[model samples]
Target: MAFTQQEIKTGFKAIFSNFGFVLLWLGQLTSQLADRIFVYVLMIVVYQSTHSNLGVSLPLLAFGIPSVLVAPWAGVLVDRFNRKGILITADIIRGLLILLIVPIISKSLLWIFLVSLLIYTAAQFFAPAETSSIPELVEKHNLIIANSLFMITWMASSIFGLGLGAPIVNFFAEKKTLAISAFLYFVSAGAIFLIPLKPQEPAKKKTHVLKDFLMGFEFVRRNQVVRYALLKLFVAASAIAALSLLAISYASQILGIGEKNFGYLIIVVGAGMLLGMLTLEKLRHYFKMSSMVIMSFLLSGAVLIGLAHTGDLRVALFLIFLLGVGNIYITSTIQTILQRKIPRPIRGRVFGVQNMLVNSAFTLPVLFFGFLADLGGILFSISILGWLVLLTGFAGIFLPKFRTV
Candidate 1:
């Protein structure tokens, strides 16, 4: 359903008045900030010690591998257990894990990878619980605004966290940086503790773990809304991942800028994301959620195609900014739809599936596009991706299931 102007105004008021959502948002903000900082610090510590790119890649593998292997089961656990308790415990465990890294920083790379693995494994559980909590905390009408706020904070944290990481590490050093990240996790735990979620009733009949895991995939297979939403999210994620790999080449060849200056383009994209979040409610007044998603896909595809042909830095920056706006529209709209449509009992499991697809997008799409860039040239690869996205958007217009959402 599309939101009216009055509903949009009321949604903003609803979000701020709801204290439970405020606390959830706070917890999310702090936890995400800590996560970004932890990653930055990990890269620095690993590079300083081993002075090898492979050493850095190993830690990233530790982070990404859990989403593939452990996330589905983690969702099962989230469904069976008390979500609030799960969230708090996950934060505390991750906090302690960050602290554990300090004493082992100088020991061995193997030990560091082990700790990183544990930390991110805990994160797999934290993620599904956190996403599943939102529908519980806010009115259905407010879901769009609430998600906008969350995504806004997420982008802000990425920009500020990475931007500040170097200076923070330079001043405080690596050990102190770890301490600060740990403290933020504790703060997140504290915020989550204040949210007034009622206890989950115990399941009357326990299902087998394998059955429960398969149930999530089965539901997605049968539910067209969820299936398509996830597909759009995967495509969006893949586009972002491919762009991340290609941004360096785009900067160097197309814009005549050095590779290091690619960050400026990213910052512009972040700014556009912030703009998109702030303006999303107004946009919703004019378009259905499905229309927004379709338009965003088309927008992103067109921007990429434009970038492939453009030589002017200003025009490239504008296109990249538009891509960021399209990205937020696609993600935030579909997330709200999932929250509204999915039954509460199975919410975590579906979102766990989502996490798996999104993380997989980062790895597989990056690898494929990196190869494509090498073999076919950066512009050629980008044009191919753009055509795929554009065609998908056009296909969505003709498909009945895509619009039913």
Candidate 2:
């Protein structure tokens, strides 16, 4: 299973040489940067508007619920349609939705939430399409590096975008910030057009797509390793979701830091993520997937427990950095493993199921934690999520069956 230096070099050469992948990277960079900016900006605005952490989380609830609800349908569309077309169409619609919110955000918070929800609904389609298209864009052996880069830029964008949010918001002021967000999506659409990717799907039978859809679930049910990896991934997703929602209040209320200062906390987390991926890129050939999987979950949980108790800003930031490291390790490993294991025809649907569960992990927990944080206070709620993560890690270790996974 180990890769040679030559193999790694060739993989890097293969992806970089492909013009289509270069375009895909540009599309991801702009769109994801905008994604971080828009989501965090909107959350901050909502918090400022209502002065309620629950209200802050409501928008995310809106974003996540629709994505989860529509994931299955979106998967079907991704498998059936031209992935490039879906990417273009999604970008256009998401941009328009961001544009529509510009003027109304100052006047109506409700309008902001509604428009954002629709924007994210469109984004769910774009995600699976892009993921499923990757196998077609590069050689099979290069997928680890491909998935690794995908995860890295995603974090790098978040680092730059989140760290830059205050400056961007202050410079553009709120009105132009919305415009900038919309502009990025449109630019992303144009970039996507440059990619020549075409995902090969199964021939249509008059029978029904629901059968094909059910088959994705059947595949999951039958494959023990995928099932284990996916469930482990789901646990990681849930912890991050809860932690992300908590960070806003943690920084603002407890840390006594303002928006800009709080974003730095997130920036540290992003930095850790970048480093984690870099470490993975260098060492992936040397480790078993189970080792990466188990260690990431354990490290994430341990860091969260420390982060929950530490009131010192410096200590909290350090823990957050480790948390980010653990987060990326879990995510990157899951994606690489899944991409390698799944067949191309049903890949979209399976990835779609992943979207559904992960978003559900996000939305439903935020819904509960928003209320919980509001009632019990932020630190207490965050500790619970931390413990839940730790418990999952321990369960993974004790479960003899997971060793095979």
Candidate 3:
């Protein structure tokens, strides 16, 4: 039977009406919340024990490094294995790893650190499975809705989890907080169980390691639109990382706020994200992905530049919200565009490459920007990066393909 446009829309609506989507979303929400809580708690534990910023950042690097290193391989596996089974196994392993840390709470920090690293590595596997699984389960027209829902839950959970973690930790013992996080992981695993979908078949022809690894890169290279979209993504993600880390410092020093007040900044960003995601479907019809991306970059840069000069906390909060809105719109749109362009077979690898590039871009700014902050004040460093973002955005306008989109 031939498919009609009306059938496509109705089919999506039917999918949303089911109990499975509800359960899956609940599981996603719980897992994301737990992920944020664990990170915040880890930072707290490290800072409390070592009293060193560098020491606290160690766990983050450990987690991020593995994910970046293994993303391509993981992506290939996602395409090769049962995506549902992979996620289920990953969540279970990660949960068990978190639980393992409970006993070592009173032990040396190294032990807990090691367990956290293992849990993060497990998560790297789960991430590609989860990303690739969504497209298989939902209708093509509903991809945007699914992705936006994921992002909404993600941003909200991140803000609230960080906001609540410290207070909960303060009220309860460290071991108890860790236990709570462990439970959340199990809950997330249960949620993965609710997603009703099978995995993709392994590639028909046996492939070599190098060829499999380059799958995502080659796909993007072949698709002109996808390549530009990814480059734009890389640029935007790097600028975001630089600004976000600086905002943490901005809260502590420039705004003279306590650690808890950082939650307010997060909330502002989350609120903006929620708004952007909710309206994105309508926006997508009017504004092309490239247009939205360029506008977001330009506006986000301008906001950062304004923020660099601002001394008032309220104003900084406002700019952050604006930044959040622009960021969400751009990111969600690009993801949707990519989802449409890339076939299901290679989506995992392409997304994995996108993830790797983004992380690589984000990593570079931190190294140099962190040093710049030490030499110059945080404000000046932020201002410099903001200017660079503005330049990139302006240069984007000159690119024929991006402008046409």
* lDDT of each candidate versus the true structure: 0.80, 0.80, 0.73
Q: What TM-score does prediction 3 earn? A: 0.85
On the 0 to 100 scale, the lDDT of residue 222 in model 1 is 95
Stretches of candidate 1 off by over 4 Å are: 2-20, 41-60, 100-114, 134-148, 155-160, 163-178, 196-198, 245-264, 284-291, 305-313, 336-345, 370-388, 394-405
lDDT tens per residue, model 3, 1-405? 124568657765766785666666777777777777777667666655764434554456556666678777887776677877887788788778887877776667898778877887787787777767677777676766676567767667876786667577778866787778878878878877877776577767888877878877889889988888887788777776665455456777789986434556767887888788767767767866677878888988898788889979889888888888988877777776787899977776788898877766535555566557666877887788778778767876987776643
Best by TM-score: 2
lDDT of 3 at 291: 76
TM value for model 1: 0.78
Model 3: lDDT to the true structure: 0.73
Residue 377 shift from truth in candidate 2, angstroms: 1.1
Clashing pairs in 1: none
Worst 10 contiguous positions by lDDT, candidate 3? 51-60
Regions of candidate 3 where Cα sits further than 4 Å from its true position: 1-13, 47-56, 102-113, 139-144, 170-175, 194-204, 282-286, 399-405
Q: For residues 99-157, what per-residue lDDT tens digits would candidate 2 score against the true structure?
A: 88877877888778788888888888888888777778877778877876787787689
